[model samples]
Target: MSVTQEEDDPFPVDVSLFTDTFCQETVYRLVGQELKIRQVFGANLGVAAPVWDAALFLCHYLGEQSVELSGKRVIELGAGTGVVGILAARLGAVVTLTDLPSVLPQLADNVSANIPSVGWPTAHPTILPLAWGQDHQNFPSEWDLVLCADIIYLPETYPLLLQSLTHLCKSGALVYLSSKMRKEHKTHDFFEEFLQSRFHVELVNCDHGQNIHIYKASLRKDL
Candidate 1:
């Protein structure tokens, strides 16, 4: 079930077929605030790119009834369409959105359209290009929290993803991941084995009654 690392196509099939030339507007409720998000449909799917419901759940868990988002640095890996990462910024965390270079342009566009509206508190929440298991030295070595949603659909990237998370997480950083529980069990088994040794993982159901799990692990002291 592992996916071989294939070169991601820069064009993403076709732009006209997947997205309108104009930006699409959407709303996400987080921490009791209805934050606005602007997104463009993928050039290939023509559907609104999927947002990570798990990240939303985490936001609710962390901010429940709190209005202030202060003093947190966040990084989101595999930020397709960049929704969760942007929401983190809107919530007041200094956020960085990362994904493959091929996917960055669209992600940048989405961030550009929404960041102004959110009035991001500081010169923060930047977007950058990064591939899993690759060099990330240009970015901060540790983040208070790291996020990923539905990035584990392909098993081949699992090891790379895990390694990248280990490298970027701070000493006591919390890692939140969400997936739709696909039929493929290998991906699940692999992560369970790989992460159990390091993280304290838990499954939390979402408002939609879907099982979204949260994985929290501190960096190994010896490492």
Candidate 2:
């Protein structure tokens, strides 16, 4: 689980793993980048909270100099607060930020407030309501990247997430999945299905103490 940092991704490996107190609009200073986002608090806390795994994924993906997200079409599933998607939007990626129907309003609000400053105009950040299992024919399948973090908690969601991941991406699409690996074997169960699927997957990084990992996956070959 040790990460090799050879000046490519200089961000510290000991990133935050847990966050409970929610902020209305917090300006996060990731290793070398800054993102201003709002997390659902007070009565609205029923929907979303700041996720550390999402933060960690951003720190590495954005920090790495070789990784180019500019102009890439990215979609994030279960994008609770839409922080990661907002950051991706800021990085010049046209992102579709999606979640359950109930969470769309708050997620859209955050995306709107952040768009003026950092978003691609040609392919602006879009908000969509996408339940994992439900298929949408209009869903963009030519996405250059599929993004998610800490979504594999529910055992029932294994098939849904896998199906969405496969359906949304065309051949050779890149997927970045992050999660705080829980002991209920949720992540392991997803990996079991992921292994059997046609996508090629690999562990990009792991934080053993936090029981978190970031996995990079791509289609193995043209289908």
Candidate 3:
């Protein structure tokens, strides 16, 4: 699939779907609004192209919690497909959807399609490139809420992810992290050991069938 980049185009498709690439769309209704997401599948896209189960679960969780989103400064780390961040924007939060540099175009496309300029007046989601540990310092630490979903599968990234989270939550930002309990990846160990050591972690929600866990954490200022 070749993406058209015409400036006048309402929805400029930036995704180039090769013979090996495939696409799927999912429409989710949350907080009385509908969000259409495009999930791309390809060998080189890594884990940042598809909308994960944890991301969907977090959307529902946020809606159910009815957390005050209006005017809140929100940042979503590893914002794959921009579903959670877009939903946050729809709920009236000033949201920044971020991921690796390679994933920004697709993330931007999803954000543009869902949160268009005309209908949405207050909240417009911003797309940016954020590589966890390395780029955390480049961003300010004044966000009201920080979000992460299904981004804990890789063991090598644990320390880096922690580093980023620690820096982002430095100014008392609340962190909402959703993860699938993958034993092979030792996901539980990250929460029990590394994360707990640095932050105050609480398991807020869980999907028993999917083995997904949603945690609410804050930086341990005492440390």
Candidate 4:
């Protein structure tokens, strides 16, 4: 998981049409046993792009949607390549792809080029600058779900990241968090802090190889 060793995943990865063996219907393959995503070069403002854990989390999301996400608001915190939010919007959620200000242009460009334009008719994805820990009253609220991937690598940012998660999610809203078990002790620390937060977290099995953990969380207390 030395992301520094590889350049950003080539942009415009195809959103494939996949059908599980048991179900013949085509589902946009956001997550599954086998996963793929389309992403152009990152903003390169620090770093931008999907890492290993992001891929695994997204794969799990594919089969978990029991209801249509149309009109549902989703905010992908730390939306590096904007792929997660893009997949959500592509599924008909009104999505906000939030990241640092420096990452917005690249994310916005990816959204426009891959998904529907921001100004178009139906559910579309847009970008907002949201630094973790800062107030985000302007970011979408009452969101049906919050999606995050690979943002827990830095220990110092854990507090801010959890704080942002609490602020953006409405009561009972679902959150999909995927992180790598790179540093076991640090990972435990994050979960320890996470348990003290307002959300309830549960572990789930994933097809991605070991070292990746996918947790589905929801607000534990009224927001």
**lDDT of candidate 2 over 38-77, digit per residue (tens):** 7665333342455566455645665563456778888888
Candidate 4 lDDT score relative to the true structure: 0.61
Candidate with more favorable, higher lDDT: 2 or 3: 3
Task: Give the C-alpha lDDT of model 2.
Answer: 0.69
In model 4, how many backbone clashes occur? 5
In model 4, pairs of residues that clash are 11-39, 11-40, 13-38, 31-59, 32-59
Off by over 4 Å in 2: 1-23, 42-47, 116-122
Cα lDDT computed for each candidate against the true fold:
0.64, 0.69, 0.84, 0.61
Off by over 4 Å in 1: 1-23, 43-48, 65-69, 116-118, 202-208
Q: Candidate 1, overall lDDT? A: 0.64
Looking at model 1, report the run of 10 residues with the lowest lDDT sum. 1-10
Candidate 1: residue pairs that collide: 2-156, 3-156, 18-46
lDDT of 3 by residue, 29-75 (tens): 87777888887776445577778899889989998998788889999
Q: Residue 69 CA error for candidate 1 (Å)? A: 4.4
Q: Give the TM-score of candidate 1.
A: 0.75
lDDT (tens digit, per residue) of candidate 4 on 1-223: 1123224222221223211111111223453212133333322344454344554456455447454566777788878767667766766678888887656766766666564434433566777888777756666557788877777666666777777777676545688777776674387677657644677778764545666777788777643
- lDDT per residue for candidate 1 within 139-190, as digits (tens), equals 6666788877766656666666667777786456777776656557365664
Q: Best candidate per lDDT, number?
A: 3
Least accurate stretch of 10 residues (summed lDDT) in model 3?
A: 9-18
